[model samples]
Target: MNPALRLPAAAVRTAGAVSPRLGAAVAMPMFAHVAKPRPVSDDDAPTMSLARGRTIRIPGIDRRGVDVAVYEWGRGPRTVVLSHGWLGRASQFSALVRELVAEGCRVVAFDAPAHGGSGGRRTYLPDWLATYAELQQRYGGFDAMVGHSFGGLATLVATAGEVEAARAVTIAAPADVDELFRGFQRMLGHSDAVSAGLRERFAARYFPGDPDPFSWLSTVRRPLPAGAPLLVVHDEGDRVVPFGESGRIAAANPGAAVLPTTGLGHNRILAADVVLDAVVEFVTAEVARHPVSPTTEAAAPLTSRAEPVGVS
Candidate 1:
């Protein structure tokens, strides 16, 4: 592939969104081909446990008596906020957080409303996006963000407006809104119209706007800011989300780099050595160039063994 066709580190750091229960339609063939069985629960899974961090209530912008959980750790000048995939909690990113904290970076993660320790019925894209905005107000600006699945999609939308993070990493995220919904519909044995209606109901009940319903891949219609970088990682063998979705984001964003791995599908990719290393290196290089603060120390260099293969 031409280097110009690749996504950049800054842009990759800020991509992706999460999805709901693994659709049977997408899971059967996909996971069977490349993904390991997911742990029964995220907290019980070894890859996602970070030493328990502090969780605080962040105000919700649109509702009354609502709050979001923010998990905070370390005291480094640079901060990384983690957003988990569907049904995942802030703690699912423990391994990544632990690694970054050890490198002198601060981290924050959230249990989207209805998941993990947060409140509400299961959430959709809008509320999560609002919660994202509200959380930014409380936590202040971050050096970068890492979002998986739905969270990745939310982060991309959130970044487009008031969110201030400069870098992001999106993992195994779906690209097109219609495709994602269709995938869910097929798994649930619902008609296209029925699925569309349910989606509208979910969005209206949980959020404020008519769902754009476009894929995140479609959302990236322009290149990332010349100064910002993005990294998109996916598994060609992923069963839950098509690898081509990630390709959409890479193709749309002028310099964003895409890394399609052989294994480590979906959830497991969160802790895959290459994934972690790629995230660390992307954030580290940007922090070095931008330098969150002159006094902030970076985490130790990630070893080559952990770096994503064939990624610049």
Candidate 2:
């Protein structure tokens, strides 16, 4: 824990000594915190503006409706859903949106609650799952779903026999949902009691009837749709989520392709030309191909099956 947060960690520990539930009640709010808002980058501004007239009003964590900014491009038969990671926005997939559109795919990407232009302050995996549920209903079925980091895990959970999607791809996603909570506990330097309480209360609130919260929340526990091709992309050098996570996901979902890159870390991998190529290719593998324009062919994925992430 940071020196500044040590005091709070101690206080939570003291509270846990009395009752883990009590400590968790106090820690839940912080656990669901969203990072400081990030301005849409200049490169992504144009794509960001595309969501101006397209937005979804979904219930927030409190049940109050909130407007989530959604960006759409193209009008092809295949509809691909893009999910940005925690603290990430829709425009982060600008490069991907362009490619999928060029491949004649109707691209749909949204800013989750409490992130980017979406409303609210705190959000969790369930919040993201709910948003996707709403979209799945509206879209009827999705041809492909691509997500980064936290969004990656949520993507699989949402699509596991719930949403109708043909294929899935994840970038820098964590393997075990339980490990995510455990990692959070480590980050906050919480005591065992406080950490246990956090899971107990969280499970009670979000996963009623499921004694073990992550047993259902996990992708491994609920593998992707059978025969649904999955592409797991991860950078070996990622510090946020380990590279081994992709291995775990691949191992659980046999025949799943594992594309390992280096140096792109977590967020930056989203826009890498190689990552985009693998995703678009896998997403559109079944559909009849579209001809690439001269410009696109000229700038083909800079990295081969061997090289790493790029297009920065």
**Candidate 2, residues 281-312: lDDT per residue as tens digits?**
99998833222233321122111101110000
Model 1: CA > 4 A from native = 1-62, 196-218, 221-227, 287-312
lDDT per residue for candidate 1 within 41-139, as digits (tens), equals 644455334334444443332343345666677788887888877666776687788779878887877776666666654344555556555666766
Cα lDDT, model 2, residue 290: 24
TM-score of every prediction relative to native: 0.69, 0.83
RMSD for all candidates, in order, please: 13.6, 10.4
> Model 2 TM-score?
0.83
Model 2: which ten-residue window has the lowest total lDDT? 303-312
Taking all chains together, the TM-score of candidate 1 against the true structure is 0.69
- How many angstroms is residue 170 displaced in model 1 relative to the true structure, after the best TM-score fit? 0.3
Pairs with backbone N, CA or C atoms under 3 Å apart (clashes), candidate 2: none
